[model samples]
Target: MKTLMLILAVIVGLALIAGGAILIAINRNGPAVLDTVDRISGGKNNTELLHKQSLGVDPRQKLLVYGERSPDEALPVFIFIHGGSWRSGNPDDYGFIARSIAPEGYIVVLGGYCLRENGRYPAMLQDTAAVTAWVHENITDFGGDPERIVLAGHSAGAYNVAQVALEQRWLEQARVPAQAIRGVVGLAGPYDFYPYDSDSTRAAFGSVGVGAESQPVNHTSSDAPPMLLVHGEQDSLVKPRNTRALAAALEDSGADVETLFLPAMTHNDPLLALANPWRRDPRIFDAVTSFLGQHTALSVPVQAETP
Candidate 1:
């Protein structure tokens, strides 16, 4: 019995040490580690094309602009929002997305927003709206056509993009016309989730009196911009039902909506596929570029090259 107890205590001590090390690594060198991994895996490129610019008074409210080296030509613009479960996420992590898509003759902007811990519900929505308005007003100087703007997001970011597109009030408050958004792309987004079963959802939306008000599915309208909803078949995190239900709602409202379900992909696979040039599944990239082509008038075909 003493021998067994000693062995168990040793295992527990090792586990505790490992856990502490991981926490310290995450708190201190997480971003650098991610950057290093992205570089080694060929997931990072076109960084020279990225230009950092401030959007508001808060330094955290800045964005990275990709493409538009030539000021003479106006290009379609795509604004992307990264997802981190409404708790943590940074625009820097998604730089590969802009690098992958910008060469396709579109100016891409990756923006950051307030997390649920910082503020709830409308906080993220408001930040995205402000960035969108800023793009509409100033993107012209950066060679982007303000009239041809597409919104794209992954996971929680997808939820924010869809919410702002559907609710209209959020953009209206920012003085941006709802109709200005030409298209939307959502990957593994939670659109119909309700009842606030999880702590993240509860913290982000439980305070709202009407649960339906928090759902993008409840805000569908015929005038909504064309939307492309992509989900992983094996995504247990957000569930395929979210995409199906939102597509149904958009269809019922006479809105243009397209749905694609990738076989054997997890919650993060779809977004990662955007960064990975050698991804086996071509559906995600094909669907996104195709959808943008059909909706937004691209000056040139997407020539996104693998690094």
Candidate 2:
């Protein structure tokens, strides 16, 4: 009887240890962990880390360039915007994405923009447009093909990128041609949430008034670039309906659009997967790379220098 009790106690202890480790892995800041590891490793060995550069005057406006710099030959570029509910988040938080995708022969640009506290509604949109304009004029210097730039983002950043891609006003205001953007990739974005009930929503979109102009779904047009909309099936923060609604609108407008709904993913899971490639759902990377390849000249893989 005592032997039986001892065995049960051992089993319970092992279960508790496993459970605690799992919680720590999931709850920890994945990007911060990667950043710390990269720093300690003397990041010079990582091509992605070595090629990172900042653009624009504000500290918030930065870009992480990936791949070898080839001034003569312009390479396809991907500008990724980070998400923090339009309140917090920086380009540095998404270095993992650039690190993962840059080796595939594309110049990944992780861009940062103003948040709600700086300005609301069109403010963030305008910031993104400015970044696009900068990329169009100067990306060639960084081995990026200006003509084949793809805009991508997650959550609030997705909303910003979608708005900039769908509506021409912001780009026009920034003196960037509407056709400069070749494609868009959005993850768990809120495209049709209106009648704001939450403080965060009200802080960003409430003052603009609940109108069709404020929604990305209402801004879709046939002229808009091809889009890949990804959403988590279990996403409770933004809901899967946002992806469905945007897809429907884009299709209705005769625009090229694709949608992917991953099972058992939450609002943050997709980004987390990008940071930790070994985690659940490698499909996010596959779908993004495949989609970009189909639309841009990113099919060729670039050779990374051995560290």
Candidate 3:
């Protein structure tokens, strides 16, 4: 009895420590905008061109596509969502993410999302699903494979990825198959965060805690797509345990999930690095390429016909 009691006590203590750590991380101030702006802008390549096109007339939402040239055949498409505290950010902020992965034979789509000011919860989710559906229907013109679409996001963007991937309704309403999602890459996303009494968080996230109906972990099952969860060990924003907990739930459901935690990097660093490849953690590129390679139908690059 004494031994068992001691073990139980240890377990409870560890849980409390972990919970405290996550709150601290969520409260972290992240980095200054100037720092990220300088890091992202300094590494531009004049040789590579990024094409900007409007997907629709939302005024707030525009599609920024990146690649060497228009794709001729069905190629893997990565729809990247930018992270802002669900308040501020634009498609331009994440154009670098699309560029970094385009060379690997994937079309990168960067677009804006509705903010808390515009709406919240299902509204943002609906906008994300709308973009996914639009890409699936029209990306063929640009040589993107609708069947191999993948969702990649960071921070709040990460959280949105989890929401759509786990919950079937958003994608279903858009008429996009849930099975069509090949993979998901969530960077420092809050998978399950619900503080019922905290009005600030509740206003944005309501009573749905991490494992609640709205949380991604709640929807993990064998049929869902594979997920890659990455985090920073020293990150004081979004917390590593969020990813850890989501990974555990995914594993329990027999889902193929992987995690990579960077040593010294922080929250915004990963987002900035996704654009300026040289400044990013190599593991970020490696994991993303590996995921895309797994789902692509063509083992080798499709060759264009000779003139």
Candidate 4:
């Protein structure tokens, strides 16, 4: 049984975040824009413990939990990572994603990981794995079932989750079973960028010395979990080829992979669709929820027979 929620009393549109004004400027101060939106979203929904550290090893890590939990029932967990070129972004700012999904009968976790001073790729991967492992061990306290966990992320965060799911060592290091991750959802992620040409890519991975080991595309196997790779055909930031290459590799390896290439979407469109007002844009959230449902997370709890 899912926890109860009343969509609250706020109007559902841009006006909700526009502060009684019809026109809001997006080109100005992105932080302020998100702050306004987060505040409104936070109020309308049950945003509790907007921040918390994982079990112990990583303190800089933080996370936010969305949705209420019923004492007698365990819902499958959905863990989401944020995009910031692996250098920027805070969990508090990304609650809109959790807000949109948690209402659909899932315990949505907006997880954050430590980024050391000039930290490279595997460090984030380790923290993400640790967070996932910790959630698996302890989310029962929050009414989440450990056996059914789905991972999703956007851009750099997308790369993080996808890589963590594809590569065995990171989760293995954290002592989490690979099968615990039921599926992966990546939005505008760079899965095959090896040369490291862009400033963001070069800074986070250039020190890695041009290796495919850090790339998720090279790690596909027949045993790989199902994946939904979404990219904007119009995305100039990371390019749609990243998703294409990874999907092709997974297909060749006899793995289950699906893709949504939005011809009109930019890098941020898929992400924006997860927030209020834009959630009805279609394909992104619908495809993800549908994919995750095919796994263990979306079904109704099995009721034990009375003797």
Could you tell me the lDDT of residue 145 within candidate 2? 84
Model 1 clashing residue pairs (backbone): none
Candidates in order have lDDT scores of: 0.82, 0.79, 0.72, 0.79
- Please name the candidate that would achieve the greatest lDDT relative to the true structure: 1
Per-residue C-alpha lDDT of model 3 across residues 205-249, encoded as one tens digit per residue: 673332256677677888778888888877776778889989999
Off by over 4 Å in 4: 1-32, 38-47, 54-60, 116-118, 208-210, 297-307
Q: Which ten residues in a row have the lowest lDDT in candidate 4?
A: 1-10
Please provide the root mean square deviation of candidate 4 (C-alpha atoms, Å): 8.2
Tell me the deviation in Å of residue 185 in model 1: 0.2
Model 2: per-residue lDDT, tens digit, 245-272?
Answer: 9999999999999998988888877766
User: Cα RMSD for candidate 3?
Assistant: 12.3
Q: After superposition, how far is residue 257 of candidate 2 from its true place, in Å?
A: 0.4
What tens digits encode model 4's per-residue C-alpha lDDT throughout 1-307?
1222223433454447765442244333332355456556545775344336554455547676666746357878889988778877666676677667776778888887765353576678887897798888888888888888999999988999999999989889989898889999999999999877887777777866647799999999999889999998999989999999999999999999999999999888788777665665767889988888887645579899999
Output the lDDT of residue 7, model 2: 100
Ranking by TM-score: 4, 2, 1, 3
| Candidate 3: stretches off by over 4 Å | 1-58, 196-200, 207-211, 277-280, 297-307
CA RMSD (A), model 1: 8.5
- Model 3's alpha-carbon lDDT is 0.72
Scanning candidate 3 in windows of ten residues, the lowest lDDT window is 29-38
Q: Model 1, range 103-217, lDDT digits (tens) per residue?
A: 6779999988887556477788989898899899888887899989999999999999999999989999988887679999999999998877777888888865448788999
lDDT at residue 128 of model 2 (Cα atoms): 85
State which candidate, 1 or 3, has the greater TM-score: 1
The Cα error of candidate 1 at residue 253, in Å, is: 0.5
Candidate 4 shows a clash count of 0
